[model samples]
Target: MNLLFLGDVVGRAGRDAVLAHLPELRRRLATDFVVVNGENAAGGFGITEKIARDFFDAGVDCITTGNHVWDQKELVGAIDRETRILRPLNFPEGTPGRGAAVFQAPRGRRVLVANVMGRLFMDPLDDPFAAVGHVLRQVRLGAGAGAGNGVDAVIVDVHAEATSEKMAMGHFCDGRASLVVGTHSHVPTADLQILPGGTAYQSDAGMCGDYDSVIGMKKEVSIARFVRKLPTERMTPAENEATVCGVFVRTDDRTGLGVRAEPVRIGGRLAPHLPEA
Candidate 1:
């Protein structure tokens, strides 16, 4: 099955780009399932119920988030009502919303999607390795595990800042997950490759927003912060034409392991690299 996992969507540009391209992208890619990180979809902070609903309406099957998941105060109440949106599994116990969930694809395949946050250079939450292991133990992949009960595929979204931390998680879940990709940073990495264990790995999927600015924020404001070393103004999402950045993986039906992993960067300032026709 073909699975498309989009990176963090930042503010209006990202959301708009997803809404404009996602429906067509899904059809053209023949995607069975889609997961988008909507953490920074709101004004470069957090996602809101309206924005999430927009994504769902646009063909996104699941939404994952990171530290910015709680930026929108309204989500604290609304997240519980929504099952498609996932917070970091390593989040403190009893946190609103879920960290992992299983959804039946349109083609009758069961997919297990899990989100975990890394501790290095991030909020030191629960052990991500343990948290992910627990979920994998629960959701066994392939028909041999079971008939209708087995999870057909597993996709792990490791939202983090450190590349080594993300790579470690990918190997940790190697042979266990169909694909393991990172998010958080707004720069897409070029290390898309299938591991020896059959899992697909990418250091980062980047942000689904304009790449002309500094990590999706206004360029001038972000530069001032670093150059002047002083708080100038609140960061806002770049309003230029945005790009849809992500990793596309096609997994084997029997083993649920990725056979092909491709980087998808379309529109905006980034060079266009859509899936091959």
Candidate 2:
């Protein structure tokens, strides 16, 4: 099974790039499932239902989010209806939407995708490791395990600011998940490898937006805030062409572990790369 996980989508540029290239990517990569982080899709804040629907129409199977998941107040109520959109699993009980869900893929295969937020330097939510472990225990991965019983693959999105926290989560789910990738930093890391336990791990998948600016925001505004040590204009997404960043993992059907992993960067300022199908 081939799984593609895209990093945080910034504003218009990022969204447009994904919509334009995703269809071709699906064909070229022969992807069975695709998950994109849409937290920052709405003017660099939260995702709107319309935007989420746009992604789905563009062939995205699922959408994951991070700290900015609730930036759009309407999502607090609408998320419950859209099972494909996932927020952090560590959110307190009674949280509007789910943190994890099992989605059906081609050939009657099941794929479990979980979105969890790291507490370090993030919101004080439930323990992400424990939250993820609970779900993994409930849904074991294997082939021919009966309907709603076992999944063919597992993908975890660890949205965090600290690289250490993200790396810890990858190691924690080493053998259990097919791929564990990080988001929120907006800068793609060079380390992309399969762990000893068979899971594909990347410290950060980076943002699917223009890299010429400061983490997708306008360079001048971001620099002013940091240099002056005072509040400036609100940060907005860069309007230039965006580079879609993500990770692609091909998992073994029998064991549900990753057999190959590669980083994906297309368009905008970053060099382009697409894994061989």
Residue 185, model 2, lDDT: 93
TM-score of 2: 0.98
Off by over 4 Å in 2: 145-148
Provide C-alpha RMSD values for all models, in order.
1.2, 0.9
Local distance difference test scores for all models:
0.92, 0.94
Best by TM-score: 2
Candidate 1 lDDT (Cα, whole model)? Answer: 0.92
For model 2, what is the error of residue 181's alpha carbon versus the real structure, in angstroms, after optimal superposition?
0.6
Estimate, for each residue in 123-184, the C-alpha lDDT of model 2 and write its tens digit. 89999999999999988776543645689999999999899999999999999999999999
Q: Record all residue pairs in model 1 with backbone atoms less than 3 Å apart, i.e. clashing.
A: none
Worst lDDT 10-window in candidate 1: 140-149
Tell me how far the alpha carbon of residue 238 in candidate 1 is from the true structure, in angstroms, after superposition.
Answer: 0.6
Question: Highest lDDT: which candidate?
Answer: 2
* Candidate 2 Cα deviation (angstroms), residue 17: 0.3
